[model samples]
Target: MDVKKVLIAVDNSTCSEKAARVGYETALQFGAEVALVNIVEPVPANVNPDLTLAPVFLETYDNSKENSDMLLKEIELKFAQGTKTTYLSTVDTAAHGIIKQAEEWAADLIVIGTYGRTGLYHFLMGSVAEHVARKSACPVLIIPNKWEED
Candidate 1:
């Protein structure tokens, strides 16, 4: 495929860095632009009357956003060896946010990472990579946490 622009979704995990690195190298090899995407996982709304809940909720949300931005900057610097990258951030549910940004940006490829959880853990958490792979109009590549020997 002639990759025009690639979107790479990143988080704090090593898996996310692997995905970003692979995406960056692919963009270099294919002469495509890479965008480092960091989706800040939003906290649930506080509907209760307790005011004490506000602090925890706000702190968690802000930290998520800050962490996401930091991760993007870290990966962008890592990829600076080859790629001139664009970094983007959004606050939302991860899976939907990625797809929406891919569509909005008109990216030709979407790259993400999975923790590779399965069985009960996967069933309980559901898979964001799986959801993006299912819903993305562009091609999606999910880099599992486990490394294949190749």
Candidate 2:
């Protein structure tokens, strides 16, 4: 698809490794650079319905970003097909963060793995990859999770 820049969203899972390899190969074939992205989902605040909880959630968000950075680094080390990697960690909603990273980097392709949820559960909870594909400006490629193999 004439990719000039690609973002591979990694989560330290086996599915992520496949997406990383695919992104790397596509980047190499298109003379593009690969950006490794990790989005930290902030932990929900402790509910009291009595006191303010934003402060607690704020701390959780900060910690989540740091954790995401560590995961991104670990994933980068596992990248085999290409050497080009830029890491990005954001304390935002997963889908939003991924889309923002792709936009900021001017990426031509967004590659990620689907958890492969189905049935009523999938309809109710939604999925990050599907959200990105529906909203992203660039092409979004979602590699189905290798459940049987991994």
Candidate 3:
């Protein structure tokens, strides 16, 4: 298939770094435009139920957005330098945000990394890559966290 646009989903994890590298290489090979996206899930304010922690939650959300933007910038510089690239930072669930960005940008392919959480942790947190692969309209490339096993 012809890939004219590539969307890469990244986070603060090393797994994401690996995925970004692979995605960048693939995009370069295909001569495709690239977009890097980072999702910042909003901090839930219902943990206290009394609204007393609203300010703290707001601050946490702000910090998350800031960090996400920084991460996207760093990934773009490291992986997509000298290439046409777009950086996107959005507030949403990770999988949903990535899918949305890909769809909106009309991406031909999506690349993401799995955290490789297994057993109880996997069951509890679910897999963002799995969700995106299942729900995305276009092709998805999921890079496993193999270094974690070493």
Candidate 4:
């Protein structure tokens, strides 16, 4: 398929940085417009069962949005020149935000990173990349973080 638009979904993680690089290179190669997006998950309404955590929840949500904005700007600065690129920040689950942005932008392809979490960790935290790959109408490219020798 002709990839005229590419959407790169990123977070404040090394995996995301790698994905950003890959997305930039791919867009450059394909001459596609790029959209760098970051998702800030809002604090759950039931975070505190006692109903005394609204302030804390609001603070956390604000901080997350601030961080997401910073991350998106950093990624955009690195690869936004010489090509059509846009930066977006949304408050929602990562997979949902990415898919929504892709649909809104009519992206032909989506590039995202996978933390490669498995077992208990993966179960506790659902895989955003997996969800996006399964639900997105467009093709998705998931860049797994390179295993580092510890």
TM-score versus the correct structure, for each prediction = 0.86, 0.82, 0.86, 0.83
Model 4, CA-based lDDT: 0.87
Q: After superposition, how far is residue 99 of candidate 3 from its true place, in Å?
A: 0.9
Better of 1 and 2 by lDDT: 1
Question: Mind sharing the TM-score for model 4?
Answer: 0.83
How high is the lDDT of residue 72 in model 4?
82
lDDT of each residue in 1-150, candidate 2, tens digit only: 588788999886788778877877778778788899998876767866787776778787877778878787777676635567888878678899999999999989999988888999999989989999999999998888863333
Model 3 C-alpha lDDT per residue in residues 45-70, reported as the tens digit of each score = 75567646667887888898888888
Relative to the true structure, how large is the alpha-carbon lDDT of every model? 0.86, 0.83, 0.89, 0.87
Question: Model 3 residue 111 lDDT?
Answer: 95
- The TM-score measured for candidate 3 stands at 0.86
lDDT of 4 at 136: 98
Which regions of candidate 3 fall more than 4 Å away from where they truly are?
46-58, 147-150
Cα deviation of 55 in candidate 3 (Å)? Answer: 4.7
As for candidate 2, its clashing pairs are none
Ten-residue region with minimum lDDT total, candidate 3: 44-53
